[model samples]
Target: MKRMLSLVVTTAALLLALPASAQFAKPEDAIKYRKSALTVMGTHWARLAGMAQGRIPYDAKAAADNAAVLEVAHKLPWAAFGADTQSGDTKAKSEIWKEPAKFKEAEERLFAEVPKIVAAARSGKQDDLKAAFAAGGGVCKNCHDNFRQ
Candidate 1:
């Protein structure tokens, strides 16, 4: 029993050490990963939007932190939307696969806008940050309107 336990622990450790791309053995795992990343991104984006909309008081540091998180988080979910992941507990629309070019364009728009938000937030200008935040949110909304249910 002890030898079996040791082998199991060794196997788990080896799996944990693998690269993230190599870690998903199933499409469901990838879907779950993407969903989790999007959830985190949404949480951070909401915080930034609250400040941008004046629903919450602006703190330069907090805005900067949230923008930084969005910069990273925005890049995470795409890889998980693999071909095998089409049928899942996701709000992702079928058009993402059917209309790949359009989807890619939307993704490109988001990638382009997120950095501007980060730069504006880091600049400590609330007005600029607010504008950037709206632009970024619009990018997200555009993608959601087209791709998400």
Candidate 2:
């Protein structure tokens, strides 16, 4: 039994370490990757919020796990907008490039909010998580709606 348990633990660790995708090799690639990650992350995050809010059923653990995904996903959006990063399938608006300062300011706002969402999600505090998730998620949507293609 102990040997079997050890094997299971080893397998789980290996699976967790699997790389999700190719690393960005250039600035443009990085931007493209970040945009993609943001969208995918946003989709999952929205579903997570729904679950947390009981727009779907409440699943505390699931919500917490989804929050973990956001922790990384949340970091990519702004990084993708760097001068070297551009030309992608994203809905990212030219305004991001046109007004670097303002665009970065918006990104800053998002960065500021994401940790709070992660915290609330981790806390398993339903209401707090929901509120933070809404705000953090909103930042993403707002940016996508305006700047992303």
Candidate 3:
């Protein structure tokens, strides 16, 4: 009984030490993770865009908070695009796996532009924030047109 207890404790510790990606037992889990991350990123991006486009009254603090959320959320979904995740309930196109270089380039473009948007939001200039937000949206559109369903 003592030997069994020791083995169980060791297994639990090993599992806990695994990387987050390594903990996914099914491709569906990765798909779900990426989808959830994209949803959150979209929510934040929409809020920022509303302010930039004048649809929503611009609050400097709210803009900054939303942009900060975008900065972090944009970095999350990419890691979940592991092998076999493409077969699940993801809108990610097969081009992501077939033309990985192109897909990565598109992803990199958004990552690069998001920081500029964040900076603009923190700059307290509405014009700069609007321009940056539009640019970031363009990057997102390009990637979606190419890589997403």
- Estimate the TM-score of every prediction: 0.82, 0.69, 0.83
Determine the C-alpha RMSD for candidate 3 after optimal superposition of all C-alphas: 5.9
- Count of clashing pairs, candidate 3: 0
Clashes of each: 0, 5, 0
lDDT of 3 by residue, 84-124 (tens): 67776778889898998998899889878989989998887
Q: Is candidate 2 or candidate 3 better by lDDT?
A: 3
User: Cα RMSD to native, each candidate?
Assistant: 6.3, 7.4, 5.9
Q: For candidate 2, lDDT tens digit of each residue in 27-114?
A: 6676667768877788767867786677877677877788788878876555445554545555566788788887777778878887
Model 2 earns a TM-score of: 0.69
Query: Over the full model, what C-alpha lDDT does candidate 3 score relative to the true structure?
Result: 0.86
lDDT of candidate 1 at residue 98, scale 0 to 100: 94
Q: Between prediction 1 and prediction 2, which has the larger TM-score?
A: 1
Q: What is residue 24's positional error in candidate 3, in angstroms?
A: 1.6
